[model samples]
Structures are given as C-alpha cells and as structure tokens.
Target: MYQNYNNNQLCLSIPLEINISSNHVAVAISHFVDSIPDKLIYEKAMTSGRPAYNPAMLLKVILFAYTRQNFSGRKIEAMAQENIPTKWLIGDPDTVPSYRTINRFRSSDQMKRLVEAMFLSFRQLLKAQGLIDDSALFIDGTKLLADANKYTFVWRKASERFEGQLDKKIAGLYQELVQNKVDLAMSDEAPKTDSKTLEKTSEQLTNEIERLDQVIATEPIIPGGSPNKRLRRKFKHDRHLIDSDYLPRKRKYESNNAIFGDRNSFLRLIRMQLLCA
Candidate 1:
C-alpha cells in the first residue's frame, strides 16, 4: 500500500515572484531569457521524447546560477530545488531537471550561441541604464565544473608538448627492446611504436620469454649448478626490460590517452579539437 500523493495537487500557494525582490538579478535574467527569439530555441527542440523543459526557464536558471558563481550542473539542480529565485524562474517544482539534462542543455551548440546573444544584449541594456562602465576592465574567469569526460577542456599546445615527450620516450624504449641481433629486424619498425604497436611488441617479448623458459626446462644443467647461465641471464634481462620499462611506458601512454581524449584547445584562439587526434 502507498500513501496518497500528487505532485500537482494544490493546497495553499502564493505567487513565487512575491518571495523575490524586483531588483534581484534573477528577475533581470528572466526578462532577458524571455526576450531571446523563440524560433532560435524552438528549432533545437527534440521531436520525440517526453516534453522538454522550456528553454527560457533553463536559460534563466543557468544565468541566475552564474550570478551566484555556481557553474556545476549538480549544484544548479540542487539550486532549482532549494533557491527561491531559481524556483520562480522554473515556475513549477515538478519541472526541475536532473544534472544530466541541465548539462546537456548547457553544453549544446545552440545554447552556446544563445548565451552569447543574451549576454551581448544584456551588456547593451546595462550600458543604456548607466549600470555598467564600458571603460572598466572585465575578466571572465568562471570555471566550469561539469561532466569531465564530456566537457573538461585543456590547451592544445600543452597536450602537444606532453605527446611529443611520450613519443620520444617510446622511441627510446623501442630501440632498447629490439637492441639484440636476433631482434634487429624490429629496429626498422621502431619508428612506428605507437601505443598499439608497443602493446603488440610487449606481447611478442612475453611469448619469446616463455619459449626461452621451455628451452631452459629441457636443457641439461651444468654438472651441479644453474641451467645454461647464458639462457638464464638472457631470460632475466628480457623479463626486467618488459616488467620495469616497456609495460610501465605502455600503461602510461594508455592512461594519458584516456585523460587527454578529445578535450584540447588552442589557448590563444581557443578552438575546440581532440587532444589525441
């Protein structure tokens, strides 16, 4: 059995705007968001799914959150539930969106243009009302705290520097891995030592070491001592190379690859491109 509950059942309510001051930035944000051309927002609306939250409401809530220095989607979700001005902008408690939905809306191509347009008009409005001094210096240092896998950004030059260093290290390791005369054919292929190539090379070294172990198992021990010191030393050396050097470099390259995936930027022009591509 469940208790009778209804989201829409109204008992007693007052106008949400009454709780917010008219001069509040949220009030201004609401007006600016409403003034955004409907066609611009409507064109991006999804045609199939549950009804979408109004784009104006999302913009107003986001802009309001910005004024409060809250850039995270999860924080905005909580704000919608707890903040009076935010609640007023959303207009209905039932329509409060999840962090995922809020982030998707915030990061969309359409949202990018809309935010720029809104701020441009907003700045003009402020200037006309003598609310802003154009001569004053402004620095936008707002840090984004969103889904890191999807939205975290880093500079391209920094990524390139790191990549170049990794490539040099890989080249050096490859030369060491194939330095022996038996494996000299691999030296020609060393220049192609990308992550996958290194991984394949590691597997080859493992197989060669295993084969050597089998040969040592069959080889006669010298009278009373170690089985063929020559093969034993060779096995130990190859094992150390893979365990201490090659494997670690391979894993580092793979981990850095994942962290730096698709998020690099050019710091000066600030274009978005893949870090690894």
Candidate 2:
C-alpha cells in the first residue's frame, strides 16, 4: 500500500512584450553589409526578366545568419519567417526562397568572394569606429580532420611483402628455365603452338610484371617493420591544423583557417567593447 501527498504548486510569471524597435546591432550590421557593392553577380532572369530575389537582401540575410552562428539555410528561412528583424532585413516580402537557393548562394564562388570582401569591410569599419587595437590580440590554433577513412590508406608492408614474393617467384622461374633448357623438346610430342599466341601471352606476362614493378617502386615507403601498423598509427594521429597569426604576415604556410561568419561580428564585438570602454 502507498500513500500520496498533495504538496504544492509554485508559479512564476513575467510580463512579455511582442513588438520592439530596431536595435543598433541589427541596423549597423544591415547598413554595413548593404555598403558592399554587387555588380553583375547574378545574371538577368530569362523568362520573367527580373531577379528572383534581391541579391543584397539575400547577402545581408546570409551574413547576418552567419554572424549569429545560424549557418543552416533552412534555419535562416525559418528565422525570416518568424523573426521580425530578419524579415525586415530581407525586405519583409510575402515569399522567401527555399533553403536550396540559400545553400546554392552560400556554396557559390561569388558568394565566397563576397563574404571575404565583407569581412575586410567590417574590419575597416571597426577601424573607422576606433574599435580595433592593432596590438593586444588573441591568437589560437585548432585542427580539423579531413573527411577520409582509415580504409582508404593502403597498407605499405602488405604491398611490399606481396611484391617481394612475386619478384622472388618470377626470379626462381627464370632461373629454372635457364638451368633446364629442356624446353629444347615438347613433352610426349604435343602439338606445336602458333608463335602469335605465344608472343601475345609473353607480352601480357611482361606487361603485368612491369606494371607490378612500377607500383612497388612508386608507392610511399613506410619505415617501420610493419608498414600497415605504422600507417594505422599515423592515420590515428593525423590532424588538419589551423593557426591564427595576430601579427599578420604576408606569406606563411599556416593551418587551414576561416573567419567565423563575415568578420562583421568581430567588428561589432570590438565596437561594443569600445563603447563600454
């Protein structure tokens, strides 16, 4: 038997407002992103003869989403649907392009260039706003793994052992043929074969031998006793390194690097810090 106790309810409530005025971050980012010039980035539509959407507005929406860490096009579309500021930035239209269109724009080479330029522009704007400190910057590095699997790596030792065995077998066969030139006579008077088939077979064997030889020669050598084991360890330890150079240098083979979003967020953060300062 069990007894239940009716013990209490605590309710917390806070007033909520639905509408709010445009804020500086949104307005500043929108204005700064709009300052990026778009010239012939999109071709004129053939059928209806007008662009499907405003390139600038799309660009602004994408950059804003990127800066806010909302990289998914689907999410951005949802935001445009529900968020008033996003809708206003995107022109508050009755329709927005599907996520596919947004993804295509993000992946395009033109879009990549535009994003880079926008980053530079944001940096300049930050400088203009006296928000950037040439000195005193943070530097860090990270590693990103390539989308490849261990199965793709060829085992060097196994390949070398196979090649060595093949070479020894071929050498032994050649030695036996030289030692017993008893090919001077056919066994039990078998019918003689045409020279063409014999020649073709010889050529094929020679080609196969040569191809195997080339593969063995050109393949990367693993230094350890077991090439496959070494390769496994190396693959396990391998990383795609990324490094940031606060004091920018022109030419240095650093790690793979990307600016988070457009550098607009960085600029805005700096501006906020300056305002607080």
Candidate 3:
C-alpha cells in the first residue's frame, strides 16, 4: 500500500504565470497571443461537451515550440510535457494536447488565415511600440527555411523596374506611330500603356499592314495613282516593330503580373530569433 497516497488529492492552487519567468519567450508568446482579439481565434464555438482547448493557449504553445526549434508535433507534445515555460503557457495541469491534435490545428486552413492576420497584427504592434520602422526589418542573421519554391519568388521592386522600362519602350513606339501619321485614333494623353493597350496596338498595326497589302494587290497604280510603295513600307515597318518589340514585352509583363498576384512581397520566413528578441 502507498504511504498516505491518494490519486485524487487536491493540491494547493498556484498561478501558472508565477512559475514562468517574466522575461521568458513563453511569457511573451502568451501576452502576444492574448493581445490578439479573441474573435480572430474563435471563429466558431463548440455545440456540446467540455469547452474546446483555448485557441490562444494552442497558439502560445505552437509559437513557444517554434522558438525552441521544436517543429515536429511529437517533439512539441513532448516539449509541452517537459518544458516548464510551455506548460505554464497551457496552464492546465491535467490537459496535454496530443501530437495529432496539435498537428491538425496548425495545418488547418483556418490556422493558415489566422497566422497571416497574426503577422499583420504583430507588425502593427511593433510599429506602435517603436520596435520596427516601416522602412526596415531588423532580423537576425540566422538562416531559416521556408516552405515555398524559390523560382516562384517575385520581388515587387524588380517587377516595378521591369514594368517601368517596358512602359518607356511602349511609349517610344507610340510616339513613332504618331510621327508616322498612323490613324489608330489613340490619344497622346491616353492612360498608361499597359499590356491590354499594347495588345490592342499590335492588333491595329497587323490589320493596317493587311489593309495596305490588299490595297497594293487589288489597286494597281495608274500613272498618277497614290504611291503604294511608301504606304506598304510604312505599315510593314510598324508591323515588324509591334511583332519584334511590343508583343513580347506585353507577354512578359502579363506573366510577371500574374505571378505577383496581389502579393507586395515574397514568402518571408519569420525567424524565431526575431520574434523572441
């Protein structure tokens, strides 16, 4: 028999936060997560049974695990058991979430959206506290791996630079069309020459060249007939410019814009060092 042992004994109550250091990363995680409005974490409430594990606590656990470089679900579960700071964040002595539960919550679509929102909120908080300037992000020199394709990374600055050069070239071509007296009926003060504008210009040039060809073929020049040679050469030159320059540039712009698609920046890895710091 166990000496004065009772499995159901109630111990003295103590605040979990007291056991965790004020300056510990886990404490920071707890405070940061708690700072986020509850509406973001609790999209829906359970209909029955004991209340679900607090999403804020789950977030704290996940973030604290990441700080410790414990990415694997099993490792995080074990860490939750053995790590005092992490256990304090959870605060429930009897409840240790299974690895499967932890993995499912992190991998869910809701979590994905929530993480994006959290990042935005985190950055805003940093800005308000004078910890980060909009112009600069001071991350440590630690190399962190990201789960995205390197080839698909599109830099906004590079895209803008290329687009500016393309527009300048297109504007030059438009000036040539004006100088040549080509009647495409476009204005000098028209909106910026985007991919659609370029495509329309290319099509107009191609049709004009075809019309010039038909005129040269069907209307034989009488002794004083309007000269076809000059007309044919002008239209052909414009057609060649559109084909060689405008169309290719338009395609490139379209492809790059498609890849960029509402993202002002590439997939950035948030190093735990930066967050914990």
Candidate 4:
C-alpha cells in the first residue's frame, strides 16, 4: 500500500479523551485549579509585566510532575519542552517555560499556601470519587501509589507470604526459559529467540520486584524543601524522626505559620496526619 503524510496539518483532529490519556491527571487537576479564583491567592494582579503562562496550567503541570517523582525544577522545565504528557497538560506545545521561571514560581511564598489549597482540593476530589474513606488516617500508602482499586489491606505475620509468591513465579518462568533454551539448542529447526525473549521478560519483572522491595522503607520526600533548610528540617517530624532536628524545626514552622499569614486557612485545609514516609 502507498503511504500518505500530512506535513502541513494545522490540527490533530483527535478526540479529547484519546488525547488526554497520555496524562489524565493533568485534566483532573487543571479542572480543579481553574475553578479557584485568583483573587483568593494574589491580592492584585500585575498587568504591566510581560505575560506569563496561565497559573492554572502551570499549577496542573507542576502537580503532575510531583506525582511522577520529578522534583528538579530544571527537569520540570525540560519535561515541559519534551514530554508529550506535559505539553498536553499545558494545552499548548509552544508554551515552554524556562527553568528559572518554573523555579521562581515554585519557590514563591504564594505557592506554599496555594499548593496546600490544591492538595486540600485533591483530597476532597478523591473522597468524592470514593478513592479515600471519610476517616482522615491514611495507614495504607499504596493509595498514594495510584492504585485506585484494591480496597482491603490484610495483616501479615510473615514477610515471605508475598515474596514467596513472587519467588515461585519467577522461578517457574526461569525454568521454562531454561528449558526452552535447551530445546532450541537441541533442535535442528531454525534458531528460536523466544527463549531469550522470555528470559529478558522474567529478568525485567524480577528486577522490578527487587527494586520495589528495596524502596519499601525509603523516606518520603517533602516537596519544595531543597531551597529551605528550615522546611526540610521540619519534614523530619513528619517522618517520625523526633530528634534534636525536629524540635527546632517544629518551633520554626509554628513561628512561620503566622508569618506566612495563612495559619487558619492552612489548618482548615489539611487535616491528615503528616506521614511523609
């Protein structure tokens, strides 16, 4: 069949649903943040300065970046330039933001409270969608892992129950793979590559499982803490590290609560216990 290409196309003519599947998260968050009145966050808008990206779109892209574990502002900037999901989130492929712009907006004092507000909004959305229960306590971190299904958490007396199953599955796959390789070597037919493919698949799965096992006890990173030593210190308390670092950080956070001028609003917005890790 002959091939055809539209080199001068002006529009994709793609359905919004199919287009958004690259990152449905962007759609969900943008909708929520767009509904937020700007006056609530900024006292007055600056009209004299050069125009910037829409706050709602920027906020959506930033929030989606965090979910993917991309924390560096430079990385975020690059994502805006290169990642289709990010471009789709922004709704304009040409609107690439500079790293400096992203970093400044991210580190702004206004963003601190704005982000909390967004998180509060997100929690409500989750509750409305029946992903999170009414109770505030979050004992299961996997809920944050994006598995919106799977409701129950079973108590486990032994670690091997889960790892044993993984071990058996991996072993069975490996055995099949080895048997296939042996058979291929013995056969006079054309060389078979399925054994090697199966080996690679099993290896990839085993490596991924091992990686998850290694990450189970890792610390939960508090966002926007790299530039603020005080905030990073404060987040230690969230991780249950009540050492010398925690007390001063706690005091500092309390002192800054009023300094930020959003103590009441912040408290009202966030009710969940701070369990970073």
On TM-score, the candidate that comes out on top is 3
Query: How do the residues 192-262 of candidate 1 rate in per-residue lDDT, one tens digit apiece?
Result: 64656655665666666677678778877677666445654664575576567766765655555566567
Clashes of 4: 0
Q: Model 1 off-target regions past 4 Å? A: 1-18, 130-277
TM-score-better candidate, 3 vs 4? 3
Which stretches of model 2 miss by more than 4 angstroms? 1-24, 40-50, 133-277
Worst 10 residues of 2 by lDDT: 239-248
Candidate No. with top lDDT: 3
Per-candidate TM-score against the hidden true structure: 0.41, 0.39, 0.44, 0.41
Tens digits of per-residue lDDT for model 3, 5-86: 8869988876545386678888777778877887888888779987777778888999999988889999999988888887
Weakest lDDT window of 10 consecutive positions for candidate 1: 268-277
The true-versus-predicted C-alpha distance at residue 230 of model 3, in Å, is: 28
Instruction: Quantify how close model 3 is to the true structure by its C-alpha RMSD in Å.
Output: 17.1
> Per-residue error at 159 for model 3, in Å?
36
- Give the clash count for model 3: 0
Q: Candidate 4 — what's its lDDT?
A: 0.57
- Candidate 3 matches the true fold with a TM-score of 0.44
Q: After superposition, how far is residue 214 of candidate 1 from its true place, in Å?
A: 71
**Candidate 4 lDDT tens digits, 148-233:** 33343222323225434434543453455344332213252432223343344434434444444455436466586432334333
